[model samples]
Target: MSHECTTEDCRNHTSTYLCGRCTSDLQQWLDKVPVLVRELSVTVARLDNVRPAGGGGGGGHQPGSAAPISLDALQLQENLRSVGTDAKAYAQDSRAAGLAWLIQDWVTKAELLVSGPDEPPINHAANRERVRNIAPAMPTRELLPWLRQNARIVVTSMDIRNWARRGKLNPVGREPQPTYHPHEVINAWHDTRVP
Candidate 1:
C-alpha cells in the first residue's frame, strides 16, 4: 500500500519513509530558509545604489530625474521588505508543524512503553467519582449513642487555667471563662473513646 510523505511541501510517497536523504535535506532547508532571507534583505538594503546618501534626493541623485519612490532602488527596497515578511511567516508556520509532528511521535512512543501487547484500559471521570463517595462521615453525636449502648463511661473536664495560660482557649469577654462548642467537646470525647 502507498503512504503519504512526511514533508509538507512534497507528499508523494514511493513506499519508503520519506527517503532518508530527502528527510535530512528537508530539515536543513527548513532550518536555513529564514537565515538566508534575513541576510539577503540586509545585504540588499545596505547596497550604496539602493539607500539614499547625505541630503535626500531623487534615487540618491540630484532632482530632475524619476522620483526616489519610483526608481529601481525603490523596487529593490520593496522586494527586500516582501522577502523578510514572507520568510518570517514561513518560519513561524513551519515551527508549528514541526511541533505537532513531535507531539504525535511522543504519544505513540508512550503508548508502546505502557504495555507491549495488552491494550490499556479506558478511564472515566464518573467511575472515579463513584469510588470517592463510598466513605462514611464520622460525626460526634452518632458516637454518643454507641458509647452509651456499650455501657462505656468516661470523666473529662476543661483545664481553663492552663488553656488560658497557653492561649489555646479564649475567655468569654470579661467573664474569665473559656467557651467550647458542644460539637468540639463531643468530638474530643469521641476521639478518646474510639482510639
Candidate 2:
C-alpha cells in the first residue's frame, strides 16, 4: 500500500499522498498564515500614512494630494486579502490537518504549502431523504433543541445529519429537519472526535 510522496522532488514512500516530513512542513506553513496576514496588514496600514510619492516635487501636480501607495504596499494588501477569514481559524488546529493550507498567500521565505489557496472548500450537502431513512427513532422535539444548545460548536445539525446519511449516526427523529436523541448524538460525536 505504499506509493511515492506526492510532493515534487521528494522521493519518500508513503501510503498517503504526503509523507510525514511534507505533512509537517505543510502544518508549519499553515501555522504561519495568521502571522503573515497581521504583518501584511500592518505594512498596508503603514503605507497609507506616508506622503504620496510625488510629494516635495514641482511636477505640475499637487503634493500630498494622493494616497501614499507603493507597488510593494499594493502587493502586501493583495496578500492580506488572499488570506480569507476561513484560513484565520487555523490557530486552534493542533488536533489534526483536517483543515489548513496555503504557503504564501501566507508562507515562509523558504517553502510553500502544497495546497494553499485563498478560499477554503465547501462540502456538498448531504441528501436529506437518505439521512432521514437511516435515523433510528422519532425522538421528542424537546431533545433536539437541547442537543443543539449543548453541542452547538462540536456537532452541528449538518454534522449529525451527514453522519446519519453515512450510517455513522442513527439519528432519532422522523422530521425532515433531522433531529437526534441527545444521548446518541453525544456518544457518536465523542467517538468520532476522540481517536
Candidate 3:
C-alpha cells in the first residue's frame, strides 16, 4: 500500500517512508555533510593550538582564551540535536565540529526516514497508515455518511455549515465543495457530545 510522504508541504505517495523525490533531495543534502565535517575538524584543531611562550609579550598578554569556541560548539550540538533537522536550515552557518557531528548523524536518520529500520518489525506493514490523501478530506456529502458510520455520531449538513460559519471546523479542501479531514469532524463531534 502507498503512504503519504511525511515531508512538510510535499504531497507525494511512496511505498517507503518518504517519497522518491524527497529521498533524492535528502541524499543530495547529505552529500554536503562530509565536506563540512572535514572543515570543522580543521577549525577545531586550529582552536586547540597554544601560543608560543614569550612571543613579543612584555607586559600583560595571558594566553587569550582556552578553546574559545569549544563550549559554544558543545552547546550548539546540544541545541541542534534537540530540535532535529530541517531542509531550510542546512544552508545556515556552521563552524563547529559539534554541528558537523549532528549533520553526519543525519545519514542514519535519513535512511530510517526514507525507508524503515534495517530490520523492521513483522507488524510494520500492518501498523502503517495507508495513503488516502494527506488527511483524506471529505466534502459535505461524503463527510456526513463517514461520520455516521465511523464516528457513530449524527450530524446534519446544516450543523456542518454552522460549525464552518462559527470557526468550529476548518476546511482543508477549498472552494465550492469545501472538505474537512475526518479527524477534524470527529474531534468536533466529541467536543459537542453531551456526557
Query: Which residue runs does candidate 2 get wrong by more than 4 Å?
Result: 47-66, 80-106, 109-195
lDDT of 2 by residue, 8-119 (tens): 6778886666667767766556556566655555554464334455454454336457656444544544554564343324433442233333444335431222222347
In TM-score terms, which candidate is top?
Answer: 2
TM-score of 2: 0.34
What C-alpha lDDT does candidate 1 achieve relative to the native structure?
Answer: 0.40
TM-score of each: 0.22, 0.34, 0.30
Residue 180 of model 1, lDDT score? 43
User: How many Å off is the CA of 36 in candidate 1?
Assistant: 1.8
Candidate 2 C-alpha error for residue 176, in Å: 99
For candidate 1, the per-residue lDDT at 65 reads: 50
Worst 10 residues of 3 by lDDT: 124-133
- Tell me the whole-model lDDT of each prediction, alpha carbons only: 0.40, 0.52, 0.54
Mark the regions of model 1 whose C-alpha exceeds 4 Å error after superposition. 3-18, 48-195
Clashing residue pairs found in predicted model 1: none
Per-residue lDDT tens digits of candidate 3, residues 65-184? 233333333333343335334433432333222343455565444333333357745442231223133348879899788767755678888888888888888988788789987666
**Candidate 1 lDDT tens digits, 31-69:** 533444344444434443443433364534566653223
State how far residue 87 of model 2 sits from its true place (Å). 11
